[model samples]
Target: MYSHWARFAVFVFCLTAPLSIAIAESDTGKNNPANLVGHGGPIKAIAISGDGKTVLTGSFDYSAILWQLDNTTTNKLARRYSEHEGAINTVTFIGQNSRFLSAGDDGGVYLWDRASDNLLMQFKGHQAKVLSLAVSDDGKLAASASWDRTVRLWDLDNLKPLAILKGHKGPVNAVLISGAGQQVYSGSYDGSIIKWSVKTGRQERPLYLHGWGINVMKWLPGKQQILFGTVNGDVQIFDLKADSIAKVLIPHQRPVLALAVSGDGKFLASGGGDGLIRVWNTADWSVVEELNLSFGPVWSMVFSADNKKIYYTGLDDYAVAWKISPRKIGQEVQGKFPRRFQKLQNMSLGERQFARKCSICHTLKAGDQNRAGPSLFKIFGRPAGTLKGYKYSPGLLKSKIVWNEKTIDQLFAIGPQHVTPGSKMPLQKISEKNKRQALIRFLKANTQ
Candidate 1:
């Protein structure tokens, strides 16, 4: 049995921030500022402290930084941990804020004593990247989901492997432990959700299927329901007792990547590759707010302890926090670029078209971090994979094509797959010749 208030406490502690906080005033006269902005690469994971005064963020730069949260002043980075050899995927604060665990692509989990900034212990068992982690309410048991398609249980009290629960056919992406620490739930890219008994290491019968690969999931506090975000961009609520999907939401246009529920069980937030975050009223399941992040796909999101704010990471290096006000529903917040680049805002028709379409995944400025796509700075004459620091697909890396006007036009005319087979770029084909020419013109203008 789960107590709502107690589960709320656990939710606050488990869900997971830093940079010069820029104050972006909304047109509604609301001051909704981006709370933190200092990661060097895309942020992969986020967790807030039990006290709500601190935040932890994991990034593709192979580091996790702890930040002090202050509303009145800009949040400051408190500590930087760089022991991991690969991109960090999941981070969680255990007990209070003093102890924390981070899992990375290196297939290792490291526990740290935050007060002393010391590495307390390291646990390794998974054969592939660990995608998600959950700690029991008592902080005695830990569950980790990995791309190896197994969920490993750890005895946190003894710092040893307890059990390995294997059943999923594809990579396990999400895991959650019951408040009492008796049961564990895991979701996988195979589209199945499996429940396991922590004590017996036995899985329950009758798997719940999502029809699409699950990307992220959350157990509702004080309720027998689980919220799942799927690769098909559907958000499904599955009832544990009824063992079926009670509700299905299609709010996003692309794959859903992150999900978070309010600590008090009043609201639910889901973010997706469509660059939108939708907030729903839990009582009626009606959408109360929709935030357009405009940065690329959102990879992670977490609600503030008070439930009045949401901190999320997207394709950008910086993790952003937005203020939430139920009274001000349907309000919009526009993205703020640096003031020094205001002249770039005077876009021609071609540039405006590119800004509306291509700007979400590609930055025009030089020296900026890569987003979903590589920066387009000086892209006109560069080779496909010549942009340094971006992880290019094998096909693009081995290609001999230079990004001239004709090649750039061909890319959108037939799609990246046709232009360069096996490229990881999403399937987006701009069939209109004029549109492609306009886009190419904008690219040439910006790159020059």
Candidate 2:
């Protein structure tokens, strides 16, 4: 999220000069405005090209957009690829930004040529949503993690399935291909990280285990270590040689949803449901800075090619960029709602409450529409985990509870995690009974 004045500053800068030069000039001060704002829905994934001259973003709008970065002109939207039938969950550049890969709730991976914006090929095998994707160093192979509880490897050259690596007890949330392209690592909702052999498609042994599900993970460059973000708000670094967690950092109060490491391997960034992005120094693992971007949960983040700026997306409809400066600390940026929702004078008190508290992450529309959470339209009579395009937690998928007034009230009474453990929904407890009742009433009225 960004403040009105901050957004205005960026707007003026963009209108006056090329973005690259504007950003370069702003580096002189830590108070400079640094956020890019132009998306229609919550962003799910972000990737930077190898040359650092381009950016790729995937969104719940069911499209991935390509942006070109240059000093001579404003960063322009190069293209918008809308081939996916469902919300895109993952996107990655294949080789030198010439081609890229994307996968979504439709359970298919699509390859695209950047220059032509053409769908080169479609690879389908997973029976469920693809949550994460990774490309091998050689760019010859791609690995995808899926809600099917399996990791599918694809031969990029042939555009065919190479192997299906199994063994995770729960849905795989994150996957990574080794720099040498010999090993594949996957983190799952089962709270285990498993390794697989690239040649045989056989799972090795569990590398690490925690009490909470792994939400995101990244491999440290040129090392046998990994940084993992957990659903319980902890980030741990696991050492391969020691086969144990070497360091644990508690930087978030809610689930850590995203993690990114700078290309130079000097900085590590982590974002969480608390709407905070923390930068850590790789040399000493000390916190360098904390950015308070008042968005909802940050779903994705990536470092700029020069590693001087970081880009992130989340509950908001735009991707935000922040300059990484050692001199800046505890900086705050505010975001404004859309013009349509700015004036709510006619809405009732209960409706206003719902809009303020529940609307950021959940939509009120029908037919399986999903934001950060599933739609609540006609929700009172449906069973949990029945949303077609949503990837529900394993506990919820097996849940037998139906949504009624009593259950809905209890959901807010104790929180969603208490009602359905391991669900992706964050802990949001409405302790006041009247408040919960009012919110539920507003939901019922709107849905009906």
Candidate 3:
């Protein structure tokens, strides 16, 4: 997309400044968050599978990792596509649906069979590192922008060079193929955005958006408007058909380096040298949400299939995934289940103790099924009979114990299973009676 956006000072390695991550779901349909995915290295680029079942991310660590979307704590790494000499700079979903293409400074493009983590094919044509990549709408061709000052089109099926479109006087920085697959647009250091006829390999339009080199450009999905950023600080939106500015926006406090739009095209996000990614409402050009990259300069950003999450890469060592809707400090609320406190709000001493000692695998709800242990919300005022959906120690289940204050005190002293028997609560005790009493009070408050 190319209108005009600006640039700022780049963050070098070892840069660590504190920036908080926050979210607001009221304007959109987002609700309380459920989970988050974390990456091992500074994430450089990210792409989501069409079905939203999987996510693809490229990192400065020289690896492209595919992640299953459903599991949050499950950081199981699947399909480590290796072969590139340098870090993977971009990964995009193309063709039939789950198919992916990854390219990097190594000047290599590798097609991947996502299900098997298999390399379908590799294409080499660029003389230098491929800086950006785009897939044709019909998925028949993949276009690569490179420092070599050339945009090479590769046959998607054959992994062979279909054609080389050369015109940029300097390293090509960005590329986009129209959804109709009839046109290709490339931006370069020469400070111009050139549209090319895909059928004839000829330049169609060349629009200079800024005085300086273009750093990034993206086409708004299903529209004639293109959004772009430059080496200075200007962000502009243009009506591609008319070649006029539709809107000029302040996308970041600094240079905008990366951009991604939500599937519905209602929201757009920009990553910049300030190590921050800002989200905006497209219809009104209002700022919606902003995220700060804690470790590195934000290199890229991507939305998940459900649009419920956005993932970004920084220059740091790992990728960071964020919940589309998160409860912010002072905005936390009690949910349908007890013991589910809103984020960052002050909790009772008892709740703090429970969180520290027992929340690792359990959800504190009355009827919810156990995670690693049984729910205990309704246990205080109820009999200690074996709960359904839980495996109980034999001695405690048949004990038919009553939950009395004295009983709780004793159980906190001796083991609950030893005092009763069928209890499966791990062996844990508070040596201080006052702390034990406080925890019991908190548990009792929620149980009622």
Candidate 2: residue 412 Cα off by (Å): 25
Q: Which predicted model would earn the best TM-score?
A: 2
Q: Rank the candidates by lDDT, best first.
A: 2, 1, 3
**Could you tell me the lDDT of residue 377 within candidate 3?**
64
Tens digits of lDDT, candidate 3, 298-357: 677777665556766554333445655551433311112122222225777777767655
Task: Let me know the TM-score candidate 2 reaches against the reference structure.
Answer: 0.69
Local distance difference test scores for all models: 0.75, 0.76, 0.66
Better of 1 and 2 by TM-score: 2
Clashing pairs in model 1, backbone N/Cα/C closer than 3 A: 16-47, 16-48
Model 3 misplacement above 4 A: 1-40, 71-76, 294-296, 326-448
TM-score for all models, in order of appearance: 0.68, 0.69, 0.65
Compared with the true structure, the alpha-carbon lDDT of candidate 1 equals 0.75
Sequence-dependent TM-score of model 1: 0.68
Query: What is the Å distance of residue 426 in model 2 from its true position?
Result: 22
Per residue, candidate 2 scores C-alpha lDDT tens digits across 147-246 of 7889999998987889999898888889999888999999987899998999999988788888988878898988588999987779999988898988
Model 1 weakest lDDT span, ten residues long: 12-21
- The root-mean-square deviation over C-alpha atoms between each candidate and the true structure, in angstroms, is 10.6, 11.7, 16.4
The true-structure Cα RMSD of candidate 3 reads: 16.4
